[model samples]
Target chain A: MPTSNCSTRSASGLALRAVADTLPLCIAVIPWGILTGALAIQIGMSPLQAQLMSLLVFAGAAQLSGMTLIASAAPLGAIFASTFVISSRHLLYSVVFRQHVTQLSRSLKVIMAFILTDEMFAVSEAHTKRSGQFSALFALVSGFSFYVIWNVATLIGILIGDTFKDLDSLGLDFAIAATFIAMTFGELRRFPVFIAVLASGCLSVLLKPIFTDSYIVIAALAGMLAAYVLGQEGET
Target chain B: MWWAITGMALITFFNRYAFFADFVRYSPGAKVKRFLSYSSYAVLTAIWAPIVFSVDTQTGFTHAGADYLIGVSVAAALSLLRVPSIVVVLTSAAVFFGIRFVI
Candidate 1:
């Protein structure tokens, strides 16, 4: 039987509630979208290509990293490698969500998977974690709406193109750093995880400037392994 | 360029859909789950480190520059205080432009 505070709500109600839940986060993303769109045009990307990246990639970190690399004239392989490493976190996200959505139909599963971004997952997870109910309507409404909002933000950015110069000068890129740092700190609820994060941060710093193409991947794997090893030791 | 985008989309879709591919039934050990939980920090760490430390300049990969460091420090400070990410971004921008305008 259904239970919890969310059990009685209609899908649309839950959807609105989910949107409401994420309203502050969404407002924050608007400026980011505008900044990215403007950067894309600034970096010699066609307005169409910029918008297309927003449409297709749908991952801000990936898109920003991609645009930055392309702007720096990084090779194609390096660009792909960097973005791929940045996004590999989604692999874990898919794993975490799989058990919840397994009972749903394949199409819904596909949509759920497609629309799963960090913020959407964070907001929806807050609700579903309590109830464990993978309501299709709720998930769809939340994720799809986030998707629309991101696209609209990107469009606004594209429209505002090129008056801004030097993303670093604007310090807008710090938003991403802040977001990622929040994600890191959010997970550090345990004492031992501190060791894991420290290991990761140090390894990444040391590995930077060493491997041109795959430092991020190497450092991340090293960090995860450090955590896994230390965690196992701590448990034993 | 289109190929690059297409290839990336394929990689990402594969990841998002990978666990549901019938292979995810073999749940890993508790250690793996615990480890996966920290993957976010690890990944974010790797992504942030290079950007924060290795600031590119017209001359070379020399310094983090006042703007980048100031921006990062402001964002990091506000974030530590539990400000929202969007607000952190806005504050960083405001501070950056603010300082530049005065001096």
Candidate 2:
């Protein structure tokens, strides 16, 4: 009984820490959420539909791309294909996360996998590295908090869609870029990772015309190959 | 519309859950594991490079505005100095907005 109580207390503490760590990211998330909502309305989605998409699909980039395709009158199959391409990067995140979450039960793993996003992966990976342990409670708290904030922000955007028509010019989307830059800068300290980043960025730009949206997946694979080759050379 | 949303949701979830499924029992080797470890850096770079570099799909090269360039540089510098992520993000946002105003 005492052991279980102590574990619960520590879990709550970890959850609190996760919330604190994730709060700043909300500034970035809120703007994107609002923008996504406003754009969804502009593209003829009912408030309910937009909210449902945010609740169900729950991925910003994929949702945005899907909306663009839908606006262009793309078929449902095209939308599904583009969403798959846009979200292929998450496959990598799941693979990396699998190692850490082996201790979790199947149902918990399902929940964990559901909340797996770029921000979630970044925050949770940083936490595991810092604490030398991964707590499911911490990851869930970080993720579900983002989930609630994002959906709420989307609702706000839907409510004020007409009045907030100028949200695009405010450069709110840059917040996501800025946050990513902050995160990637830390990873660049490692030599092999630096090479990998360079490779990915270069290939992404170079292959954009040839590969279009699929370039993200291809370039990322090239980057990983670059890092692997460099690691083999003992340059890490 | 509902069909599209359902399809997107299922596909997105499947991508996230595929590796964790009960059927995926194969363990990766050490070298494969090391390669997988670089995935975050690789994927994040793949996502941001085009936006930051202004790699126009049509024209192939447009200048990334000074505001974005400078904002990202400041963020990278602060992150290198081991500043807190929150500070780095806010500073970069401020720098981005401040530059947009001036120019």
Deviation in Å, model 1, residue A219 alpha carbon? 3.2
Instruction: State the lDDT at A24 in candidate 1.
Output: 50
Q: What TM-score would every model get versus the actual structure?
A: 0.72, 0.93
Residue B75 CA displacement from its true place in model 1, Å = 6.3
Off by over 4 Å in 1: A1-17, A20-32, A42-46, A64-86, A121-142, A186-189, A232-236, B23-25, B54-103
DockQ metric, candidate 1 = 0.40
Candidate 2 clash pair list: none
Cα-based lDDT at residue A183, candidate 1: 45
Candidate 2, lDDT over the whole model: 0.84
Residue-wise C-alpha lDDT for candidate 1, range B1-103, written one tens digit per residue: 6666676666667767788665558565676766665665676677676666763345544434576677667866776676755566567766765765665
What is the lDDT of every predicted structure here? 0.69, 0.84
lDDT tens digits, residue span A148-179, model 2:
99899889888877778789787676787777
Residue-wise C-alpha lDDT for candidate 1, range A112-229, written one tens digit per residue: 8888877776556556644666565766777888788888988888888976555446544555555566545544655556666677766666677676545666776678788777
Residues forming the 10-long window of minimal summed lDDT in candidate 2 chain B: B54-63
The TM-score each candidate achieves on chain A is 0.73, 0.90
Per-chain TM-score of chain A in candidate 1 equals: 0.73
